[model samples]
Target: MMMKELHYSGSFTVNKPPSDVVNFITDLPRAIICIPNIINYEVLSKDKARVRFRVDLGNEVPIAELRRVTTDAHIELVSASGNEIRYKVDGRAAGSTISISLVIKVEGVNNGSRINWDATANLGRLLQMIGRFVNIDSLVKSISEDTIKGFIGCLSK
Candidate 1:
């Protein structure tokens, strides 16, 4: 079976210093709250966490019928440098092992900062079949954009 890869990259400007932008994002406790539909997160260690997410099934699926599919991913903070933070996420979502590597870079722009981010996900055959209907690209882009916005918004004050 061939594994399918989904990729996304984008840049956004934040109204904060690079240090503050990077610090706020790398801080999970302060960052998770900005996410939508994040059921909860369990910090296994300073570098590892298992995050639960709630996916809306919409009205088609009845209340008792698979309303929420939780993907428990073991996320690890791989590295944090002056310009970037790298992370890895491994977990099973929809019965397929999904692995993702993400890198976020923050550089000083004017008085604020410019964030360059990219993420790649390896989805197994199962997810590829389901991926057709999942709109993974849109989902990823939306999440990434919101994450940056959320981080910057929360820290600007």
Candidate 2:
């Protein structure tokens, strides 16, 4: 069966240093709070976490469980350089198996830092059939944008 792919990218500026930004993004507990659809997260270990998300797909909230594999956060001293945090998430939801990779970069800006988020998801065949009618890319973008905004809010507090 052919698989469906979705990609999303977004960038925002935050009033904090790159180190601070990296720290904030790496905090799974704090970051999970920003996910509008996330019901909760259970930490499996120091580097692994399971997240229960009620994803809003315009019809209803589909309960999904995702396991995250995270990379150690890296920070660069150069102002133009950025810190990077990468993770791979796998889950099942809406009668489909989902897999995604997310990378977030925080770079020092004029007064603070700029955050760039990039994510890619591969959906099961069932979702691809549905995507032929709806724009899955847009939906993914919206979700990504909201998630990042939630991260930003978490840092502001």
Best by TM-score: 1
Question: lDDT score of model 1?
Answer: 0.75
Residue-wise lDDT of candidate 2 within 1-157, one digit each (tens)? 7676777788999889889988766766555557666666776554466777765556422322222211122111122224888777777755677888888888899989998878788887656655665567776777678777777787777
**Span of 10 residues, lowest total lDDT, candidate 2:** 69-78
RMSD in angstroms, all models?
A: 2.8, 6.7
CA displacement after TM-score superposition, residue 109 of candidate 1 (Å): 0.6
Off by over 4 Å in 2: 59-82
lDDT of 1 by residue, 1-157 (tens): 7788889888888678898888887886666667567778888777788887765533443334443556767888889988899989898866778898999898999989998888998976655664455565666667667766766678777
RMSD of 2: 6.7
RMSD of 1: 2.8
> TM-scores of the models, in the given order?
0.83, 0.80
Error of 2 at 63 (Å): 16
Segments of candidate 1 deviating more than 4 angstroms: 57-68
